[model samples]
Target: MITSELLEKYTAVKKTFSKNETIFEEGNLPLYYYQIISGEIKMSNYNDDGREFIQGIFYKDQSFGEPPLFLNQKYPANAIAVEDSEIYMLPKANFMKLLEENPSISVKIIENLAQRLYYKSVMAAEMSTQEPEHRVLKLIDYGITHFDFKKDQNGYLINFTRQQIGDLTGLRVETVIRTIKALEKKGKLKIINRKVYR
Candidate 1:
């Protein structure tokens, strides 16, 4: 998890993502590691046909684009904030220096990437074997374990659209809708207008 002291060292930038704004696009040169202070960022990509697809969703207190910064590599996917948000950015030079200066920080970064990879592997397996609804539940469970969702009463408050969730889970939007509707019908989840709860 990220700490306030870590944030104190970085410059906080007040930026807004008007509904759907691209923070960083895929194939761009890796620059800074951004920490979300508020709001959510939807990491996604587009196919060769120019079809947009969501890859993952990140919320507050989480960091993104750090893994590929090991040696200033290009981003593998696009990152866009779901709503207006603020981010604390540590430029590559400062970020790498900070880690090199602190062994503990480097260890934390390694552990964070390892954990993310582990969950991604699990999601991959689930995508091959589970249904769309089950995949969504698994994503929720994965988020809960990684982000401490249960610690807050509001849960994760993921602001992604159904289509975005489908992209993340490798399911179609219609499948996501049907699965969510099924979950709501079973009283396993709450779908109030556009928001989702479990």
Candidate 2:
């Protein structure tokens, strides 16, 4: 991610959204480079039956929906604020100019994109062949590494809710709950004070 100092130079506007607000919807044309300054955002899509599948969750200091910007295509999923949030929006032209002027930032962006691609590949394989428990654990582990989740004396605490876990793992919420309890019993994770840690 680019530092705030560098981002400030190119930021076109600062925008705020309320919880559950859609920042952008699927099939929208890419226009801005969005970087979160506070709160959480999820890139997701809903099935025909209205079940949500989260492509990714992003927090403060992270950027989302960049692939479409670079590819000159429409957004593949919706970005919604999970809570009231502030974000920096850089015009697409300005974002490209910034990347051209800053090679290091461009390299960092490429690395971040590659990491996302790797995560998607791994999750795709897991969803197709892995059991619920395995899929859940893989999702948590990926979040810990990719999202910079922190550890305490107990373990690395995962911040996602059960519903979010289900969405990310392509499982039903009931299944996610059962799988998590099973994981706890198997010593794979701990649910301390109702929060999952691993």
Candidate 3:
């Protein structure tokens, strides 16, 4: 991600978004390069039945919705704030210029995008072929590596809620709950005071 000082130099504006606010809607033009300052954001799409599938979750210092920006295409999913968040939004033109002037930052951006692609590819295969336990554990492990979930004496604390897990894994919330319980019984996971640890 671009550093805060660099972003500011490129005219990136830090703006606040309330929980549940849409940063950009599905099919909208990609006008800005968005990087979170604090809080969470989700890119998601809903089915006709109103069931949502979360494309990805992003946290502080992470950039989201860049593939479309690089391609000059419309957003494929809606970007919504999971909580009241402050984010740096640089106009697409300036963002491109900043990248051109900073090769190291550009390399970081490429690596970040590659990691996301790898996660999606792995998740796609798991959703199509793996069992629920496998899917959940894979996600947790990826979170530890890519999302930087913290480790403690117990284990790595899982930051995702059951609903978020369900959406990410293409499972029902009931299924996620049942799967977690089954995992606990099998020594694959632990739920401590209602928070999941892996």
Candidate 4:
């Protein structure tokens, strides 16, 4: 993501959102490049039954919803604030201009987008064929590599909630709960004081 000062220079505006607020809905035309300054954001789609299928969770310093902006298409999923959050939004024209003026930044953006595509591909495969344990472990491994997970006495702390994990992995919450307990029994994870560590 672009630095705050640089983004500010490019006319990016900072905005705040309450927890659970919808930043943009699915199918809306993308007009801005969004980068989180604090807290979390999730991109998701809901089925007819209103069960959310999470596409990705993004944290501070991470960018979200860029694909649609780059492709000049409508968003495929909704972006929502996972907590009270601050974000920087740069108009599409300015964002494009910034990229053109800064090749290094453009390269970084491409790399970030590629990483997301890679994650989606991996998760899609896991959801289709992998066992529950395998899918859960794969997500934890990916988060360790890509996301900013906190570390504690036991190991890297898994910050995702059971419901969030279910949403992301296309599993039911009950299944996620059962899977985590099974993983703990197998020495794959630890559940200490209701928190999960890996």
Estimated TM-score for each candidate: 0.83, 0.97, 0.98, 0.98
Worst 10 residues of 1 by lDDT: 150-159
Identify the runs in model 3 with alpha carbons over 4 angstroms from their true place. Answer: none
Q: How do the candidates rank by lDDT, highest first?
A: 3, 4, 2, 1
The Cα local distance difference test for each model comes to 0.76, 0.94, 0.95, 0.95
Task: Tell me the spans in candidate 1 whose CA falls farther than 4 Å from its real position.
Answer: 7-17, 147-159, 192-194
Summarize candidate 1's per-residue lDDT along 61-136 as a digit string, tens digits: 7788876777667888988878887777777887777777777978987897888788889988999999787998
| lDDT tens per residue, model 3, 1-198 | 678999999999999999999999999999999999999999999999999999999999999999999999999999999999999999999999998999999999999999899899999999999999899999888888888888898899999999999999999999999999999999989899999998
lDDT score at residue 17, model 4, on the 0-100 scale: 98
Residue 136's lDDT within candidate 4 is 94
| CA displacement after TM-score superposition, residue 167 of candidate 1 (Å) | 1.2
Backbone collision count in every prediction? 0, 0, 0, 0
Q: Report model 4's TM-score to 2 decimal places.
A: 0.98
- In the range 32-91, model 2's lDDT, one tens digit per residue, is 999999999999999999999999999998999999999999998999999999999989
Kindly give the stretch of ten consecutive residues in candidate 4 with the minimal lDDT sum: 144-153
Clashing pairs in 4: none
Comparison by lDDT, 1 against 3, better one? 3
Off by over 4 Å in 4: none
Q: What is the lDDT of residue 106 in candidate 1?
A: 82
- Native RMSD of candidate 1 (Å): 2.9
